[model samples]
Target chain A: MVEFGGWDMPVQYPAGILAEVKAVRKATGVFDVSHMGRLYLSGPKATDFLDWVLTGSASTLRVGRARYCMICNEKGGVIDDTIFYRLSEDRYLLIPNAGNRSAVVAWFQRWIDEKFSPGCTMEDVTVTTGLIAFQGPGTLETIDQVADTPLSGMRPFSWTESAIQGATVFVGRTGYTGEDGFELLVQGNDVVKVWTALTDSGSVPCGLGARDVLRLEAGLPLHGHEIDEKTTPIEAGLDRFVRFDKDYVGAAVLKDQQENGVQRRLVGFTLPGRSAPRAGYNLLHQGETIGAVTSGSYSPTLDTSIGMGYVLERYVESDTVLDLDLRGRIVQVNVTALPFYTRPRRT
Target chain B: MSPDDRRYTKEHEWVMIEDAAAKSAVAGITDFAQDQLGDIVFFELPKVGDSLTHLGKMGEVESVKAVSDLFSPIDGVVTEINEKLLDHPELVNQDPFGEGWLIKATMTDISQLDGLMSASDYDAFTAGPQ
Candidate 1:
């Protein structure tokens, strides 16, 4: 176990990270992600307030659906990458990274007080809720054994409120892993029952270690690693989430970046051999340091070392060769596409 | 289990004298070491015929979380390496004593083995201070 976001969480189970990762990629795995913050926002002006604050246009999001978005500071730097779920006409659920919960809550409260007064209210629901992700190709089959409604036909990013053994559960067809999966939001007290039911039905109990590997393989940027308080969404290659059609907190800066290209871009690269290029390693071109790695690991699926890092904008294209300084040894790496792994489509 | 015939290093490497007349020995990381490393993904081995000093850096072994330096327990010249680890690094995790053996070396001086701890002493060392 390790301390993550002030919570003692398992890094891996007895099966270990490698086995857990393979299980998720091939069959099914479950993750206890209750540490993520759950914030509830509701008011007469909820949609308008979300439009002003979030990068994605929440005004158009219908109930029972979720959209991946980011909250940026006035300078356009990302405060936190989040998911906004429209639970009701006036209420929305904002899930943020665990480490940024307090900060995100404070940021929302400040915005609510400053702009949308009288009607807006924000509540921190993290302590009362338990979040679990049932992921991989076999997720639907495993969840079907316990879910009251069959989840096989649920579209991605859609959610439904249902019951599990008399306890109310919010099930969403959303996941951080690249695999098809479902995320369950249940009352804190009912977490164990829900977890046991799925695990007994064939979902492998995984830990945060496999979660990191899976997300990395999927090319999903992590909070502190890919997007942070100092990085703008444009530089992070997340401009699509920044809806220019609507005005937002950092709309001007993002719009300017869109017009004039960003100086640095997040790019993916793969090593020629087994030597893993870890975070803080330097990316060099012609003996000059261009940028540094953000997240890297030995990919169990690819059977090679792969990583994502911010490099000079010119070096962000496919087939661009750069030297990764692992410790002191420089190894050649090829700049590849963002997602190193993609799940096979079920036709 | 740690073998009685092998001498152990505090760093978790084990050396067993293979030919006393030629001052030759075989070395590998212990089972405890592999267990601590979780999954072995890569091994960086020193080339054969390389000279190493007692307790000197030899190579490195990388797992999912970290890359740890392997150390030589005695002054020796490398005779052979476990080339199989180049392709199947998990051998260290699966069989640390047998197929996972890292290197074979001809020691410059056999007396350096006296500095290493016995298997029982190593067990106590790993168990932590009482």
Candidate 2:
């Protein structure tokens, strides 16, 4: 066990990290993501408030839908990457990373008081709710066994209200593992029942270790590593999630970056062997340091070492050769495209 | 419990004198060391003919979780590294005391083995704190 975001969470189960990662990529796995913050926003000006705070406009999001977005500072640095769901015309549920939960709530409260008070109200239901991700190629089949609603019609990023083992829950066709999956949100008291039914029907119980590896393989950016308070969304290669058509907190700075282009870009690289490049390792081009690695690991699925790091924009193209300083030993690394691993089912 | 046939070092390395008169010895990390480093995936070992310093870092072993330094228990000249570990590093977790032996070396001073801990002493030393 390890301490993550002030919560004692399992890094891996008895099956070990390799087996846990394989389970999710090949069959099915479930993650207890209850530590992620679940905040409910509602009232008359909810859409307006969200449009001002989030990079993506919640005003255009229809009810029963979700969109991935980032909350950024005035200077365009990312506060946290998140997903918000439009539950009703005036009500929405936004989920934030566990470590940034308190910060997000405070940010929203400050905005509500400054601009949208009396019309917007916020409720923190994290402690009362439980979130679990059931992810894999055959996830819909397994989730259908427990969920009382027909989930086949739900498109990616869409959600529906349902019942699981006699408990009311929200089932969303969303996941972090780059697979067809369902994220189930239920009352805290009903978590165990829902978890048991899914496991009994055949879902491997996974931990946070596999979660990190799977996300990296999918080319997803972790908040503290890839996009932080000092790193802008454009530099982190998250431009797709940023909407220039909408006015938000960091729109001015991001718009300028979009027009002028970023100085550095986040890129992916692959090493020849299993000795993976680690975080903080320097990237060198012609004996001069150019960038540093953010996340890396030995990829069991790809049978090679892969990593993502920020490099000068000039060195961001495919087949660009760079040297990774691995603890003083220089090893050659080749810049590959983001998402080193794509599911065979997807393409 | 640590095995009785070999001696141990503070860094959790175990060395067995294969042939004392021939100045030859074999060294590997202890069972406790492998257990602490779960699922080792790669090893960077010293090449044959490289000299090792007593209690000095000889190589590194990277598990799926973290990378850890491997320390030499005795001053010696490297004779051979375990070639099998290149592809199957998990042997260190499966049979740490046997097939997981890391290196074969020629001891520079036989007296270095006398200063090492016995099996009981090593068991007691590792039992304290962490």
Candidate 3:
């Protein structure tokens, strides 16, 4: 186990990262992601308060659906990327990264006090909840065996309350692994029962190491690596999540960036061989440093090296050739589109 | 268990002297090293005919979580590399002693082998004090 976000988290199970990754890609894999924060917001002004703070328009979110969104600071820099699930007309659940839980809760409280006052209530439900993610092409079949309510009709981004082993849980058809999966939020006491049920049903137990590779292969940006206090949504290529139709805290800055242009944009690249490029490695153009890698790894699925980095706007286009300086050894890389691997669409 | 036929280095590399007359030896990382590395994903190795000094940098082994430098246990000249690892790096994790052997080298100084630890010594070194 490794210390991550103040929690002792497993980096990989006994099966190892490679096997766990293969399990997720081919069959089913389960992860204990209980460290992630779950915040509950309820009140008449809940939607209004969320709209003011989150980049995505909360008022438009349909009940039982979740929307990917980010909370940005006043300077237009991303504070944290989150997913908001509209539990009901007046209630919502916001899931934030584990490390940013305290800061996000404080940010929410400040906003609530300033705008909604006593009209809205914000509760940190992280301690009381345990989160698990089941991901892979075989996720539905594996989960259906244990779910009290058949999960066949649930669409992507939709959630519903269900029971597993008689334990109440919130099941959402959302995941970060770029695979068909479900995220289950259950009472902390019931986590063991739920985990045992999933594992007994042949779901391979995975850990953070497989999770990182899976997300990187999918070209998903991790918070500290790709998006941070110094990065705006426009620069991170998350402009789609920033809805300009509604005003938000960092709306003006994002709109200005949209109208003008970003100085640097996130781009994906592939190394010619197995030499993996790691974070902080420099991207070189002809012998001059152009940018630094944010995240990289040897992609087990692609059987090659892949990486993501923020390059100057001029170098963000596809087919651009650059050299990745991996610990002083320069390896040629081709600028590719985001998502080095995409799952075959389920027909 | 470390094999009785090979000598170990402090850096976790092992050398098996194949021919004393020719001063030829085969080298690979020890099982302890592979266990610590998790799943081996990539390997950067010196090509055949490259010269290596005792305790010199030979190459690197990258796992999913980290990359560790591979050190030459003795002064030598690379005669052959395990080409199989180029396509299937997991051999290091699966068979660190046999099929995963990294390189065969013509030892430039056979006397250097005297300084290496025996299998029992290596086992003790890895096991630490009781």
Candidate 4:
């Protein structure tokens, strides 16, 4: 077990990190994501309240649908990237990163009072709930064995509540892996049962060790490691999630950036050798420091070193050659588009 | 064989002496060292002709977690460096005693190996007092 954000979480099973990584890439693996925070917001003006708080257009989501959104600070910088589920007309659930739960919740409460109707109520449901993500090609089969409800009709980013072991649980069609999977949210007491149910049926128990590699290979962004308060969604190649058509916080700054263009854009690259460029590595051009690596690792699937970093916009073009100052040694890297690996999402 | 009677360095490296020819010795990291490193993705090694002091930072072994310094067990001039680690570093994780073996160096002074821990002693040192 490893200490992460004050929580003792398993880094790998006895099967080992490499085995867990390959298992997820080849078959199915289950992850205990109970550390993530889940919040519930309800009130007459909940939609209006969320519309003012999140970057995406809240008006577009229908009941029972979830939208991937970003919460930005007053200065137009990202506070947290989250998924908001519109459970009903007045009830919404937000899933935030585990480490940023308190900060994000406080940010929302202060803003809601300043901008929304007084009927709104905010509740932090993280401690009361347990979250699990089953990701890989064979997740459906594995889930079918334990979950009482059939998940055939569930589409990506959609969720449905069902009873498992007499407890209310939420199963959403979402995952960090670039594969078709489900995120199960249940009562805190039932967490162990759900985790055991999946693992008992031959599914491997993956830890954060393999989780990092899987998400990296899929080109998903990680907070603190990849994105931070200084990073805007526009510069991170996530402009699709920002809706400028509606008035929202950070929209004006993003609009200005769109008009004037961004200074640095995040790009993916593969190292020339197997040596991985870790976070905080420097990116150089013509032997001069021009960018910095946010995250990198040796991809277990692609069998190469891959990394992501913010480079000057001019250098973000595909096929641009760059150098990574890895521990004072210069290593060659080629700028590639997002997602160095492009296997189809396991449906 | 287990080197049934070879001496080991505290850093999880082994030194096997060949008495037949010139009093020479071969050295490499032990099984315990490779197991702790997980998967070695890259190796930065010294050349065969490179000379070293008693204990030098001869090379590095990089795994998925981080890069670690590989220390010279018995010191002299490097006789041979494992060229295979340049392309297939995972071999180190697979067989640290054989093809995954790191380097061979001729001892500058025969007494250098005296300070190194024995196989049982090294195992205890690596295993931490238990």
TM-scores for chain A, candidates in order? 0.99, 0.98, 0.99, 0.96
What DockQ does each candidate score versus the true complex, computed on alpha carbons?
Answer: 0.70, 0.60, 0.79, 0.58
Alpha-carbon error at A241 in model 3, in Å? 0.5
Output the worst ten-in-a-row residue range by lDDT, candidate 2 chain A: A338-347
Scored against the true structure, residue B41 in model 4 reaches a CA lDDT of 83
What tens-digit string does per-residue lDDT give for candidate 3 at A255-303? 9999999899999999876678889999989898889899998888998
Candidates' RMSD to native: 1.6, 1.9, 1.7, 2.4
Candidates 2 and 4 compared: the better one by TM-score is 2
Q: Cα lDDT of all candidates, in order? A: 0.91, 0.91, 0.92, 0.81
TM-score (2 decimals) of chain A in model 1:
0.99
Top-DockQ structure, candidate number: 3
Q: Of models 1 and 2, which has the larger DockQ?
A: 1
**Which segments of model 1 are wrong by more than 4 Å?**
none
Tens digit per residue, CA lDDT, model 4, B18-99: 5525656776777888777776788888888887665577878888767888777766787877777788887877887777
Tens digit per residue, CA lDDT, model 4, A47-125? 8888888889666898878888788875668888998888888999899998889889888889788887487889998
DockQ pick, better of 1 and 3: 3
For model 2, what is the C-alpha lDDT against the true structure?
0.91
Candidate 2 C-alpha lDDT tens digits along A1-347: 88999899988887777788898999899999999999999999999999999998898999989999899989999999999999999999999999999989999999999999999999999999999999998686777777887785689999998998899989888999877788999999999999998889888888988898899899899988998989999999889889999888999999999999988999999998888788899999999999999999888788788999999999999999999999999999999998888888653
Worst 10 residues of 1 chain A by lDDT: A142-151
Candidate 3: stretches off by over 4 Å: none
Please state the Cα-based DockQ of model 4 relative to the true two-chain complex: 0.58
What's the C-alpha lDDT at position A344 in model 1? Answer: 93
